[model samples]
Target: MRLVFGLVLIAGVALAGGAVYMARDYIAQYQDQLARERQATKDALANVKSVPTVGVIVTNRAMKYGEPLVKDDVRIVNWPEDAIPEGSFVDMAILFPEDANGERFVLRAVEKDEALMKVKVTKPGQAAGLVSQIEKGMRAFAISVDVSSGVSGFLRPGDSVDVYWTGSVSREFEGGGGEITRLIQTNIELIAVDQIAGSDVTGATIARTVTVAATPEQIAALAQAQNTGQLSLALVGVQDDTVATAVEVDQRKLLNLKESAPAPAPVAEKVCTVNTRRGGEIVKTQIPCTN
Candidate 1:
């Protein structure tokens, strides 16, 4: 029994030693493979060159029009130095001179990571108001609006609209004066609803007045038309840039009334006068006139 136990112990020891040797060899192979992978990765990285970049300021969050800008609303990212955009700001002081605080506003909606440009933001310390939204060389003009005329108060800032003038065409024309509604402007962009300049798209409240961006000529024309007649707005879609044809409606046209023939022209009248003279005194007699 002792001899058999000794032989069994020897066999168990040899099996244990063999298992340990195999384990060590497996670990060594794994280490060698890992080292080779590490060197290969390093070589690949060395061959790949990275372009140098410069820091640029951009909006940290998506911003809406007329919203005040703050330090938290912006961030800096490494931009390709060769691809820097014009008017991009690289330093905080340049974008917010004198520590403008929250006085600066975005004139238009800016997405996250969009480059902060001087043209996209209002002047330092200036609020994004109706004037900022107004394009250069353009003026703002407000006209009274109501439920029927203002698309049931669905009109919002930044919406395009068509303006119409409704009143009598001529007060002293034949057959009395005719009422007419004519389109005065087309594709006019509304800058504000009441006093708010930002886009208030919610139709929760009705706006009493809507302001529109207009040129000097348009302003003058609208000013005169507003006084001469009742001006109304027809809301147009933002994507709709279709040019509207001249649209005019009168009572005759609305009811499909036949146009009356023009009145006959009047003839000029002729008159003759005879003069009788005695010495230096003279007497004149008038004759009847005929057409």
Candidate 2:
């Protein structure tokens, strides 16, 4: 009985030693796994920090206060996919002179009521009004003429007219030959028949005066024509084939030239003394003969 009890005690000691050995192995394996996980986490963090950051480059010399932020003007710090929120105030460091550090620019939130952008730049010496002020082409003055004047009656705004001038003039040449007659001004534009005509004139029998858009020089020329010659408006109908021409005539001077023409010269009569002779006898006689 004593021998059996000693063998049982020995077996129990061996079992406890094997159990301790297995537990130590398990503990070591768990510690190695934990070390690997820590190394992996450090490697991931280092890779994230090593990634390059993107930035924007501005080409415009001046920027508005709240202009829409472009991607090239901004640089992502740690977060690459995030976008800068609208209404953010951007500093000058982000706008002017290239090569500024990313840390110099700070974005602050702007209120909803604030303006998003500004237009502060324009041509030199010109005042900036609205976007409408910058017209595309040269502008000219437009004259309005009543459509009721002869051709004006049928004229509509935008119809091209051949302006004619009519007047009277008398002229005396070095030899004193002159006459006068009436002159006419024709073929002037019927620009705006009414103030409310569309950009391009349209419609038939426009109720308002036809208006003509012309340069300042053209206006002066038209005024001169009107003053010198009784200006008459001629409508260029859709089918009118007559080409425009300018004519000046002086009625009184023309009439006077016709009346002042010199009369024809009178012929002179000659009286002749002739000698008369008979058939058989010669006789001398003096007689007055008219030829």
Q: Please name the candidate that would achieve the greatest lDDT relative to the true structure.
A: 1
Cα lDDT tens digits for candidate 1, 1-291: 999999999999999999999999999999999999999999999999899999999988888887888889998999999999999999988777785545788876788889999877898777776666777899988898887888887777778999999988676776447788999999888888888776635555577898889999999999999899998888888678689999988898899999789999998767678899989999888988555
TM-score of each: 0.61, 0.32
Q: Where in model 2 is the C-alpha error above 4 Å?
A: 1-152, 170-189, 199-209, 239-242, 246-260, 263-291
Cα error, candidate 2, residue 245 (Å): 3.8
Q: Give the whole-model CA lDDT for all candidates, comma-separated.
A: 0.85, 0.46
Candidate 1 weakest ten by summed lDDT: 196-205
lDDT by residue (tens digit), candidate 2, 1-291: 999999999999999999999999999999999999999999999888554433322223233322334435443232222343342324434343355332221112223333222122222233322221223442333433444444645665346666554544433444322332223323444434554333223345534334555545666776675565444566667667776554544544445545467888997866466566688877666577855
RMSD from true fold, candidate 2: 21.6
Candidate 1 RMSD to the correct structure:
10.6
